[model samples]
Target: MSRWLPWAVGLVAAVLALGPALGPGYVLRYDMVFVPDLSLPTVLRGADGFPRAIPSDAVVAALSWVLPGDAVQSAALAAVFVVGAAGAARLMPSPAAAVVAGAAYVWNPFVAERLLLGQWAMLLGYAGLPWVVGAARGPLAGVVRSLIPAAVGGFSSVVLTALTAGPVALWGRGGLRRGGLLAGALVVVSLPWLVPALTAGAAGATTDPAGVEAFAPRADTPLGTAGSLFLLGGVWNAHAVPAGYGDPVAVALRLALCLAAVAGWAWWLYRDRPGFGPGLTAAAVLGFGVALLGATEPGRGVLAWLIGLWPGFGPLRDGQLYVAPLALVQALGLGAAALWLSRPAGGTADGPGDGGAGAAGRGAGEPGSSAEPGPAGPGGRRAHGVGRIAGVAAAAGLAVLPVVALPGLLWGAQGALAPAEYPRDWLAAQAAVAADDRPGAVLVLPWSAYRGIDWSGGPAVVLDPATRLFDRRTVWNDDLVVGTPDGGTVVVRGEDGLAREAAAVLGPDPRTGLPESLDAAGLAALGVRYVAVSAPVDNRFWSDVDGFSVVVEGPEMTLLEVLAGPINTEEADISGLEVTCGLVTVGAIIWSVARSGSSLGFQRTGVERRPGARKEIP
Candidate 1:
């Protein structure tokens, strides 16, 4: 009945350690806020303001449904991970081994944030992993075998989670094979949500423009590469590695101790008969090294790298900075060492009397049984070594967890500093165009406001009662825009240095030696609507142009709707298809999942997904 003592102790310790995040710090320190933008009720988009991005929206939506309170839902996620880490910790042979691995895990910035924020699906994945590793150990008596699956099936996001537990279902042997098959069936059950994400161009297809561009890789490759591997953790957000982890002083010391611990344990394992599977040990070491180096890419990653070549390895782009294979390696290395140490030197049976996982206590079998322990000769040495590693890790954690995780508790995770606000006055000026125009009208706004365009929400924002314009795309001198007969819009950008270029745009084409200026008659000829000028450029733009009535002029921006009326005569020669380049990635994901990969398939996309538009109340 009590064969699972180590696991239970580990679980309790994990819980007690991390419970602090669920309180005041989580809200102030995370993106998960109680402020409701109400974007979850419908689809969310950027400029089109019509069809919504369902994948990211759906997860938030689900949370809205399950737990009515946002804070509760958020804390619940942290709790889930606490349980997951605990369960995984519990699976280790000794509480000390669990402590070392758990310390490495909790100290990781990404891991802590994921647990603290409502990364519900990821926490589930984390929960399932312990079971997967434990079940791989064959059989354990006293504990209910049925509990094995709870660990494996833990992290299935409706879309990507399938990839996580999918591999085992294919060709695994014994319990893992059976459970993998069962998990595969369960993933199949979730196909309704997963299949459409593949076809629709959301899941693997996404390549967020806003994320990766902020960190220019082409500009600095090596630092970027190392940083991508070190910090950021995922491909999309993979940028500069932080000063932690490999902290010149901290990591150097940690590595020295880890090396020393490994040396002691290796000697212990090689002493007597020289048993233990070489393949298992090799896999652990290799996995640990790669994981320690961390994930270089975010999403699915570059097509053919050695680690990525492995099936399911594609999605496992993040969290490798310090967790992933490191956990498994530590597990195997420590487990083997523990087992080896518990062996009595002279070969005398210690039975359940020795202070090891002693012969199946309680309902567990007696001396010669399957789950029983051997003699306790030098078992104390390995236990002591494992304990030393934990002490080192704990010491390192004490150093970092305070300096890093403490103040992070004060603010949300997005920008460490407050970003300058967008010029809402220009947006408000643009907003006025809707009031003057007819219902469901298309209003062409300046390209600058495109970032927050979709916040208008629902049926209203798509075709507002304003002139329809491609604010994010079409701009002054844009070929199709200037060539079109739609004039009920505005063009806003920095007019200071751009005057000459602006003059050239509204004037003629020097390249072809042709004149393209639309006169007052040309304004009607080119669907002249509005040209909202931001700030005071030169008076020349107003003087040169024939008819520009100032409908409303604010402190910083000016509204310039053309008096020439609507010119629907000609359509702009716009080219290119409206493709969500990020969504196009589904093809590659489909190909990879169907085909074979090189190593163990990667497991997670640790970066946060885009947030839904938060529409301001009228």
Candidate 2:
């Protein structure tokens, strides 16, 4: 029962949080977009800039072949909560503590905001963090196996893993060797996107310095930016905050919970001296510092300078992402608090000064601690009974505290994340484009990267589905337009050179993504064979235009075929280098698993040191 409790809790949390989102169809919000029968070849071909969708989309496309795309989406989203809760829960010694940790880990503001932002891939890696920590002292195979979720999540996830687990691996039993192994594993798993990014030249990897200010973390609660971040809720996008999450009462309660959790962590660290404690503490501190960097002018300048120095440093622009490690620390700390609260009282045997024999006994040093309360003298038993009842009630309250403090995460984020089916016209447009063996790329019109579609019965902003709807390469506006709190917008320059050329030719209206007139000759010259107007727009510009033929026209989507002179129908293909790297990564993982003879899930909970070995915290 104890072993299965965490899994059960995780599943229940997922069900409660997701609600109608797990029913059917795709939950399209911000960056999260899913299309049926996604083309694997097209995903592998990728776009001009960083292959952000590479292996994640590629994996999704492959899975869509076997399962419905909606089902795949539901499973992926559900996995975030389930895996996260289970992993965090396993870190605790007792079932009650596990329940608290698991719930706290998955129900926090970080998870809520990221989920609302539709960054399910990043969440997938977030879910796997505890497993990575657990596997830090194990064999290389165990590390690789633990990183599967991160591999699927792509670059950001890999970076987060490095920030969170790098310290643990380096300071663990094998020291530098373990660190080297971790680095090797990260590189191998990152090949799909890493190879492309390296060979993409300077242009493909370029990032806008303007994005530094635009994506910086902001205060979401009455508590200032630092306080909000400490409570794990300072996401950059205001729209990503959960409904009713900023109520003053809720903020105060959450702040108190965070302070208590931090205190519990300190107590547990001093008492248990768990092997991972020092390293985890270092990681949490470093991550929190990074998160705070964006809240100040000097730190923002430094971050901007870093981005200017190298485009790879662009990830640092979103400082809220760095708070992920802090979230993990808080979850563990909450668990430790529950452990302390529920321990038998009235004697030193199960109290704070028991030489780490209470909750610490079941900590990382002893993974499978199952000690139960035993009877004492009659007077001691009476005291113990009262303490046990009170402790159990307190532990139960702690377990429910996260839910009470952040009530907005209940029931599909209060219906902000409901699923929506693709309109028939959109599906028809996809079919029309796929049926044709078009050699040229599909140009997504509106000349904007994101769309506020009403297909979901509500206005949900998402990256244009047309970008990945077809079975060929797509050219669309990649520029990000971020709205500031001061009622202004910041337009971050895009990285795709070809898209920039298209924008120049079209000269699209700044507000509306539509051009004054259609330029057929110019598009054909740029290797654009089909133009897909993904958003609802007036079709007056399409009329009497030579070299342009309307293929599919509807209120939602308009597909046009360009037949001006000779088209540069050259198509991009997955490079031999990319294919080789992908194969090598897969082969390496297989070899590592074969050599180890056991995977992460199958491995014992803790690493066994030599007999008579004195555990060192640092």
Candidate 3:
């Protein structure tokens, strides 16, 4: 069971990593997508528009687009697992000790979260940095290959912002000068996009306040401020993302496992070479950071100082990303501790050169110490020490107990998957819209209904009644943009004249209703011809409208031909509303999902409830 345990955990982990791409969460946004480039519909759909930040999941998306999700996630995960194991083995002081470290990491919740929740940026950083660290201390050939890591770190920066830059800049034992020079070069190169982004940012485009945004939040409040830092330190059981995100059970278990790992790591370091000093220094600094950040003024003084000093950190608002390095360091330390703990307490019974035993206790001063430093590198006849059993047990505890709590996770994933409880409506209304997208027609379909228009090159705007009238804020933008007035063939949807009413709010068509024919109007100028409405009555927005033409009717959705009136200033205003909505809706979904949930599981659970409702409500 112990031997198979690692493989079993790995297989399940791989599957969980594959879940996002294989399931509805990824595909659901295929329609209202935002790409990194401002040019809409040019490439992939993203939560943010044309931003340098790429979703870390894009790696998985690219892979899933080609092969199956399982293979892609597994391969990526395998690389992390293997590299992590190798690193531990090299440092564990013994081969068996290294094995124990491997078991601990593979089964840890930190690794589990990264794999399962699409934390590709962190994973990528882990993959690249270790290689860079090895290269920094290894041969010239390794340094030359370090370019691979440097380059990957550049892309990962786009995912996690400037956070990934830390490992690349400082992973090696090289002096600060060398690290500074390398980091400076990377920063200079990264500036093209960063510059434009800052320039764009300077324009002060307001970030769409989606979810429970604590905009202009009170950094002065002691309790809230303390809560933020507590959350950041991973000291008080931090959730994964957004606000209060993370499994409570996983949170508790994660904390316990993390503690175990850190303790074991300390033991390993001490066993390999006794030194309470460095570990004590690290603890002091961390505790200080926690204290300073938790003070009444979170944005000033020591909290600010910590952020500035936290190497490679850039301007970031959220405190969650700050905790990553500490987590990894703790894990590595734990692995080392496990190595030490695994060795026989009596002494180097294995032999003087044995690493496992060397790691377990300071023992008789071996040549590897300052006295010997061993026979140079891995080629040295170092003793292979026994692995730590407690570390293994702790890791095992995490993997198994989670299984015990699987029932809770089911509710979590299922709830997240079921956010919006809308009745299923398939292609019923889609049939009426032209199958092939025609270039010249000013086509208009009901909001959220894209039957025929080729979204391949253009974008879809929802012309729903609820959207046009009530509050006018959309996930896209807080306000709408009105369009130029030109009489276009109006295609009204459904039996209700509400589409007409929604149409009338803009201009000439407000009371008169959509005209019967439109020919001379330019596609963009005339707005949309043939509106589609779903409701049959003169609903809230449509009660004042004249009539509508139903092209198709079905049990599920209805399609109608709506003749919209001449484009006027009123229409232009509405178009701005679209832009506003697109800004809020398209740009902020990821921010919302990652940051807004009451609990970490809620992010996933809330997603299933009704994605639209979540945005709409707040």
Highest TM-score model number: 2
Task: Report the poorest 10 consecutive residues by lDDT, candidate 2.
Answer: 348-357
| Greater-TM-score candidate between 2 and 3 | 2
Off by over 4 Å in 3: 1-12, 16-41, 44-52, 55-174, 180-256, 270-315, 348-475, 478-618
lDDT by residue for model 3 (78-194), tens:
455554434323333444444444444433333433333334445545444333333332223333233232233234333332233333334324535544644543444344333
Scanning candidate 1 in windows of ten residues, the lowest lDDT window is 457-466
Counting clashing residue pairs in each candidate, in order, gives: 49, 0, 100
TM-score of each: 0.44, 0.93, 0.49
lDDT per residue for candidate 1 within 333-359, as digits (tens), equals 343334333433333212222222322
lDDT values for all models: 0.34, 0.83, 0.34
Q: Which pairs in model 2 have colliding backbones?
A: none
Question: Could you tell me which 10 consecutive residues in candidate 3 have the lowest summed lDDT?
Answer: 601-610
By lDDT, rank the candidates, best first: 2, 1, 3
Q: Looking at candidate 2, what is the lDDT of residue 528? A: 91
| Top of the candidates by lDDT | 2
Instruction: Please identify which of the two predictions, 2 or 3, would achieve the higher lDDT against the true structure.
Output: 2
Model 3, residue 417: what's the lDDT? Answer: 16
